[model samples]
Target: MPDVLQQRAGVSVLVCDVAGPPVATTETALDLIGNASFGGAEVVALPAGRLDPSFFTLGTRFAGEVMQKFVNYRLRLVVVGDISAHLAASGALRALVAESNRHDHVWFVPDLAALDARLAASR
Candidate 1:
């Protein structure tokens, strides 16, 4: 899959389609943010595969640190694609997704269609 920057619901977004844990640290997150900012993207949609598995591990600070970079830059982030298997293994991650979805900065969704809907609704 190819990574691309796109516009959805009048919002600029960078959609990453790379396979397997592409983003694992704050630096990686910042890199994405920088690219998105340069492209005038207010939101960045990353495939689940691009994220390290440890990101879903609640005990680790990986998710928080990575997400913090987005928040600090005021960029909206969407972790796109399915994460049912991960959620099933950890109640904390499930809760986190539920709560994060209630806000505008970060979101976890099941697919591209769902992400499009979310962007639409926000507008």
Candidate 2:
């Protein structure tokens, strides 16, 4: 399936396919932001599996770079899927996720349902 544009809690969202290309660099992040913009989406829901392994490692700064790109573009980002394994391996990442969840710019959810609930609550 291709990436789909959807509406959740009245918010426009671009739900990326799980089988889509991995987001491993800032360029790819820009591509996603551009896609979201072109699709008239305010948010991008990316499956966690599409993220590079280094994104979970704070030392690499990959996550920060990619997330910053989304933030700079004024688009929200939701990373959906199980990331327990990644969280268990990095304390910094755990803190980052916790902090990010507290904001409106970036979020990490277990599934699309969770993302829906979050979007509803934010509304």
Candidate 3:
């Protein structure tokens, strides 16, 4: 399946396929942003599985770089999936997730339903 444009809580979202190529670099992240922009989506919903393992390792700074790209483009990035294992391994990552969730630019949610709830609350 390909990435899809969806509307959740009256917000346009580009929902990426789980089987899509891993977003391992900033350039890859830009591609996603471009797709979302082309689709007129305000948000990009990327499954956590699609993210490279380095994204979960805070020291690698992969997460920061990719997320910064989204922020620079003024697009919201919603990482959807269970990241318990990653959270368990790094306190810094855990804190970053916590901090990111507190804002509107980036979020890490366990499922689409959670993302919907968050979108609903934001509006």
Candidate 4:
């Protein structure tokens, strides 16, 4: 279920169901953010099923653009679910995680619990 929601607390989060290689459409990414705003979510969390190598490579393309917009606009993003397998097979991904960590706008946590904690701390 890839969707976006605007929380009652005035926060918007886009829940992503994107897996596999990143799609070649910017509109698709924008849709996720729009829908989340429509819902009532303040932060976008990558569900457990959507964590894949492609998501990293493809998703990271927008790291400084669209993804950064989400964070800069005060939206939180969580991208860790069952990434152990993702981390094991891809050195590029490992590096991506390490690089992504150098910044505070994005978070590469271990799971939803950690994601929640990070988001809470952000608040």
Candidate 5:
């Protein structure tokens, strides 16, 4: 129902629907993470189909601001869905994925099932 930012299964997940303007503040992001954390879900899933284009720019500095919320909260964030369409349009997106995956806190998964696999593996 809302974005979440809290501990789940020993890891913090930030569940969010790709609706509304991308959360602009750490407070809002954490609020979302807190709201959606349930059943010990350690990974958050942001559905791709609902992402607001106006807020997500391929090469923009938005990454830092957006990422800061999760990183600051010490949470792991997974944006899960068919991201190929988005990746296909920009090399920057592909690079972003690569770079994000290199980190311990952020992930770009192809789908929720894959995310589940990742979550399981992390344990």
Candidate 6:
């Protein structure tokens, strides 16, 4: 089951526990999104290993599509885990992560603790 909590006064974040295989495509992204929506969650947290390698690559449209969907649905997405290698590999992706972190919509953090702090700060 997913955990939903109010981080701040009224900021609710949904921590998703993805079971079984990894999230490799748009379909998987949608599944998570749908679940979040159904549960009335404002933010969704996807662990590091749940995502595929392509999501870390800027050239691939997987990340874009997934991000767009989250935005379109008015859902905040927090990708929790270490992405040092991916950031080191591409400057574009690094920039994207930095920019996303500046807002309350989407964020990429090194760990769940960082994500918790981020959500708290947003409110």
Q: TM-score ranking from best to worst? A: 3, 2, 1, 6, 5, 4
Local distance difference test, each candidate: 0.87, 0.95, 0.96, 0.58, 0.63, 0.80
Please provide, for model 1 over 1-123, each residue's C-alpha lDDT reduced to its tens digit, 9 standing for 90 to 100.
666778788888888876633897888788789988998888889988889899999799899888888999999889988899999999999999999999998999888899999889988
Better of 1 and 5 by lDDT: 1
TM-score attained by model 4: 0.60
Q: Which residue runs of candidate 5 sit more than 4 Å off their true CA positions?
A: 1-30, 34-42, 54-56
Every candidate's CA RMSD: 1.4, 0.5, 0.5, 4.5, 4.2, 2.2
Query: Alpha-carbon error at 8 in model 6, in Å?
Result: 7.1
Cα-lDDT of candidate 6:
0.80
TM-scores of all candidate predictions against the true structure:
0.94, 0.98, 0.99, 0.60, 0.67, 0.87
In TM-score terms, candidate 1 sits at 0.94
lDDT by residue for model 3 over 17-115, one digit each (tens)? 999989999999998999899989999999999999999998899999999999999999999999999999999999999999999999999999999
Query: Which candidate comes out best when scored by lDDT?
Result: 3
The parts of candidate 2 lying over 4 Å away from their true place are none
What is residue 57's positional error in candidate 1, in angstroms? 0.3
lDDT minimum window of 10 residues, candidate 5 = 49-58
Candidate 3 local distance difference test against the native: 0.96
Q: Model 2 lDDT vs. the true structure? A: 0.95
Per-residue accuracy of model 4 over 1-123 as CA lDDT, tens digit each? 434343423335555655533433455446555665566666677664543334655445643455665665565556756677767877876887787766666667776566656655656
